[model samples]
Target: MFRKSLDDLLNWKNSKTRKPLIIRGARQVGKTWLMKEFGKTHYEKAAYINFDNNERMESLFNGNLDIERIITALQIETGVKIGTQNTLIIFDEVQEVPRALTSLKYFCENASEYHIIAAGSLLGVALHPGTSFPVGKVEFLDLYPLNFLEFLSAMGNDELVELLKSKDFSLITTFKGKYIDLLKQYYYIGGMPAVVASFIEDADYEKVRQLQKEILMAYEQDFSKHAPNEAVPRIRMLWSSTPAQLAKENRKFIYGLIRQGARVKEYELAMTWLIDCGLIYRISRVT
Candidate 1:
């Protein structure tokens, strides 16, 4: 799949004073896939590491911030030769290891030739006021779910996507039926990579819904595991109520939809948590 962010990645790769890159997005938004894809396409070699629960990787960055030593340890861990050449190093779930995130600063200063990209799911929550963030040492790209043009490309409708991009009103009008059908399918399928990929393979609505349900279940599990215990129930309630709220003609996130007389303050933290997790998108109305 072609992510718009790939262009940004290329620009960063070719920049004279490029820092390490951080690809931030909500869970299951294809962050890892995009990073790996970029590496495969552009770099001669890539070393990818995930810091989520690996104690050893955490321990590796636990001590010093020396750029050369850190790079050596990373090569040993991944067994991939990484140098200042055409190599990309990916740190997946770097928020799990704050020191690994901190090391980006040294990477930026001491060894600017090495290319690094890090991504995390709950990075927004991880960078608390007291945390040690590499403020000016990294470039960031936010990846969202596949947009309409990407979705079309994924579905083998590249020509239609090109036509839409060209803004040829007459051509677009002639093929309005095809575009309308694709639009309806896009709405029904949504943009989660897994769901869209599944739909592409089978074109089965039942299977698409099943995969979407699995994604929801995984997200709920993540909430239960990652969210604060005090706000877990409220988060579940607020998130679960989204479908019903949107089922109405107007999709306002009214507090009452969560429960009887649900005050804004009651679920504010939960709403914010969901937003940070990238599960729900809230758009404010224009005054």
Candidate 2:
């Protein structure tokens, strides 16, 4: 899908002082695909390790975090020979194994030559209370859904993208109708990779709406599963009320909209949780 982040990955690889890389994003924003794609095109080989529901990985990381021993286990699990050069090591859902995340510190300090990229859907909420993170020892890349230009490219409008990039308003004006049509499509698809891909294949508006609903349902399930138990109900309430809140003329968050007499103190955590999960953005009015 031609992510612009691939270019950033290349720069990270070429940096003389590169550290282990961590990609952070919300679920279904294509973190896994981006990491694998980066590895496939940029390295001699890629060793992929998904920590989700893998007992072997859970057991391997539960013990000592000796860098050598961990490398051997990764090679055995991924069936790719471990190397210090020309290999991209991927740690998918590293939050599933907190120790695996802490081990990135060791990788950065000791086995600096090996290229590693790690990602997790719930990194913001999944870590245990005291799990050590590799602060400052590793680099990070924040990924987002495809923007308008990338979305244009994905829809096989590369020439249109090039024309826009050229900044020739006269030339671009000739195709205003085409651009406006595409803008409407992009608005409906809204940059979610799965939704956009489905639209690309089937071009069905009904199917696009279905996919979006499913994604929202998955997120609601995540709230119950991962969010603090006390905040689940409030989160759901705040989330479901968002559209109505935005629909108002003022367009500012009002506690009253969530429920009758709801106060900031009552729903702050719920709002914060949504923001942390990247499910919603909070834009404050300028003072």
Candidate 3:
């Protein structure tokens, strides 16, 4: 899979003063895979540590913030040599351990020579409630579902992507049938990497829908798994209402839609949770 974000990664690698980088995206949007790919291609060796359910790693950070001690522990855990210049350290699912999220600050300040990329599906949502964020200590790259052109490229329609880039309306209009057909496919497939790859290889609409449904299920599972217990129901409510919310002509989120006589005050946290998880897209009305 050719990711457009590879260009951004390359640019970051070439920068003189780079901080720890965070790749933010919805779950299953290939954040982890992209980080691994970049590391494999660019670095001599990569040290990958997933903080989710790693008890040893959780304990490793409870002690002092000694850079060498941390490095030693990381080398033992990942079995990869950690060098300042040639090794890329990836912290996956860092939100599970709050201290791991905060460790980026120390890495930024004391170990600036090391290249680190951290990512978590719920990292944005985790910042709420008592979670302290490492503000101004890391750079971020936001990844979204493949846009229209990327969708075309992934489907082996490179010529169509080239045509869109050219912006020649006359030529585009000449190929309206082809573009419309592909656009409809994108609407149904919706650009999740697994769904798109399946459609590309098999051209199966049923399989595509199945993949999308599975992704949606995984997102719901994440709500209960990662969100606070009190906020879980509210999050699920807001999430379930997203299709209806977008289906309406007035797309602004309405609290009442979630329940009978629902008030914004009641579901604000739910809205925030959905946004934090990248489960729904929000467009605010601007007067």
Candidate 4:
């Protein structure tokens, strides 16, 4: 799994005045794996803490914003010796604990020596509900589904990736069949790590579809599990409508398509929720 984000991660690791870094992406896009890989390759150890449904961690940040106390709790929870210079601290699924999200500011201010990386599938959405974001306190890296070049690398086509990056269109045109074949595979597999990994190993289209379906199901479960009760139904409705929405010639996402004569005001929050969860991509027309 040669992720293109490795270059960005390497840059973050070598920066002289680095702040806490946040890896933002859609769910199952390998944010957690990328953090672990970065730590393994660049640091002596990684202190990984997942803030979802962990009572002790939730309590750690409930009362105060002391950086030392938070570090101690993280060390205790992860059993990794916290070294300012060598250890990489990863906060995974961080949106579950709002205070932990805000604590990045203190970390930036008081514990600048420590290398911290944070990632969450719903972090953007969580920050939207008026959560105090660590505005200037952290750096951000946005991860997307594997681009065509990454797909080539994942499938052991490093030479092809090299060629594409070289931009020799005449030579590339000679191998257009190869690129087109891989592009079709990428379309059906769609850059989710698990799906791509399975397709790479087995070359089984049926298994790929099954994995995509499971991922879609997990996303629905996330809505019911983590989203506001009032917004869950709307989210589900908006999410389920995506295939139909994209199938049209004009993919601008009409609210009426979800129902007869539906208005944008009625489904605005639902659309926002789906976008927040990374289930849909929104493109607006600029006149």
Candidate 5:
């Protein structure tokens, strides 16, 4: 509910030379909701188009890279007059339609007047290889789980959030119990937006864990549906071992935990796939 990215979106809107924005994150991290809310609050109207299994969208961007034609069709589709100053055009799941992603290049070069934001669950993976991604034509914003202050804001603790922001150590020390209790809740709840929302509303730990498991299952489905066949098993193995890997004292990710004789090379593709899809985070060791 309280996303700091909206502040960055505001900055992007006011900039003189703004390019199309791509909001990237893992599935169910509120990327789509953030884009729509920014549009609702900041603009006269938002034209939202989802490209996931959208056949009409496929036809729309498939024809040519002519900016005018595309804009006109978008106008017809979204029922909002495409305007330079007021309308926010949101291309959701743009990765599903590679041509639409490519068309952003022409939009950046030719139709810079219009504001466009594109986002999808696995857009990061789609931009690699084969797809002619609009490399230099788009700006990117990443949405992550709520940090401590943001979590406070979501729980209607605006004053506490502001106090934390003020960086008053003596004052914070006095509020240790309150902060500690919230921090413990956050530890159990984690930071995924949906989980936070559900927890905030119902305070059901069982439901929260269920939602997380569902999200995990969706990711496994993505592995089977989207990842290469040979790597799927390796991905599952590596994924299943993450808890044990982190349980070690050093907290280093070890390939050996994935299997008795596992090597990095053997599971590198799986790791790369997870990273590319924003499913996992990797902290590299300093050389």
Candidate 6:
């Protein structure tokens, strides 16, 4: 799939003052794919390290974070020779290892020549309370569900995308019917990468709906497994109410929609947790 972020990664690679990059997004938004794709296309080699459920990785980061030693260990792990100029070191599921997350700081301060990009689905929600994040020592990119143009590209309409991009209203008007049909499809598909991919392969609306439900199920599972115990019920309630909330004429967040008499103070933590997880966006009204 074509991702606009690939261009961003390229720019980061060439930047004179680039820091270790971190990609943050909700699960299933293609963070893992984007990181690997960036490396495969742009770098001579990619040292991909996934920190999920790997005790070896956990132990590596748990020890002293010597940048040289870590680089050597990663070379061994990925069987890719590490090089400052041509290697892309990827830390996948990095939040699973807090010290690994912290190590970005040392990479920035001590080994700025190397290219490093890290991503975690739950980076916003799962950092251990005391973990020292590499604040200001790393750059962050937030990936999101594919937008309309990316969706069109994935559907093999690159020329159409270019036509729209050029803003040639006279030529675009000739294809208005096709564009409207695609717009309707985009509405139903709605840009979730996995779901969109399935629709592309099968052109099955039922299957697309099924995939969306599965994504929602995974999110509910995250709420149970990662959210605080006290907030689980509220989180579930808030999530369940989202569809109805969007259905409202004004499409504004109303605490009372979750349940009668619900208030911001009572559910703010739940709301905040969802926003941090990238599952929802909060738009504040400008006074």
Instruction: Report backbone clashes per prediction.
Output: 0, 0, 0, 0, 0, 0
The alpha-carbon root-mean-square deviation between model 1 and the true structure, to one decimal in Å, is: 1.7
RMSD of each: 1.7, 1.1, 2.0, 1.9, 1.3, 0.9
lDDT of each: 0.88, 0.92, 0.86, 0.87, 0.89, 0.93
Better of 2 and 3 by lDDT: 2
Candidate 3 per-residue lDDT over residues 149-175, each given as its tens digit: 888888888998888889999999999
Q: Which pairs clash (backbone N, Cα, C closer than 3 Å) in model 4?
A: none
* Model 1 C-alpha lDDT per residue in residues 1-287, reported as the tens digit of each score: 77788899999999998999988887788999998999999999999999979898888888888887888899999999997968999999998888898899898888989999999987876554566789988988888889999998999999998898899999999999999999999999988898888887888999998988887898888877788899999999998899899899987778898999999999989999888877777899998
| lDDT measured at residue 88 in model 2 versus the true structure, 0 to 100 | 96
For model 2 the local lDDT of residue 191 reads: 89
Over the stretch 191-234, how does candidate 5's per-residue lDDT look in tens digits? 88999999989999999999989988998898888888999999
Candidates sorted by lDDT, descending order? 6, 2, 5, 1, 4, 3
State the lDDT at 287 in candidate 3.
92
Indicate which candidate wins on lDDT.
6
Summed over model 6, clashes come to 0
For each candidate in turn, the TM-score is 0.94, 0.97, 0.92, 0.93, 0.97, 0.98
Scored by TM-score, the top model is 6
Q: What lDDT is reached at residue 89 by model 6? A: 95
Query: Which runs of model 4 end up more than 4 angstroms from their true locations?
Result: 126-131
**Range of the 10 consecutive residues with the lowest summed lDDT in candidate 2:** 275-284
lDDT of 6 by residue, 1-287 (tens): 99999999999999999999999999999999999988999988999999989899899989989998999899888899999999999999998898999999999999999999999987889888999999999999999999989998999999999999999999999999988999999999888899999999999999999998899899999998899999999999999999999999997788888999998999989989999999999888887
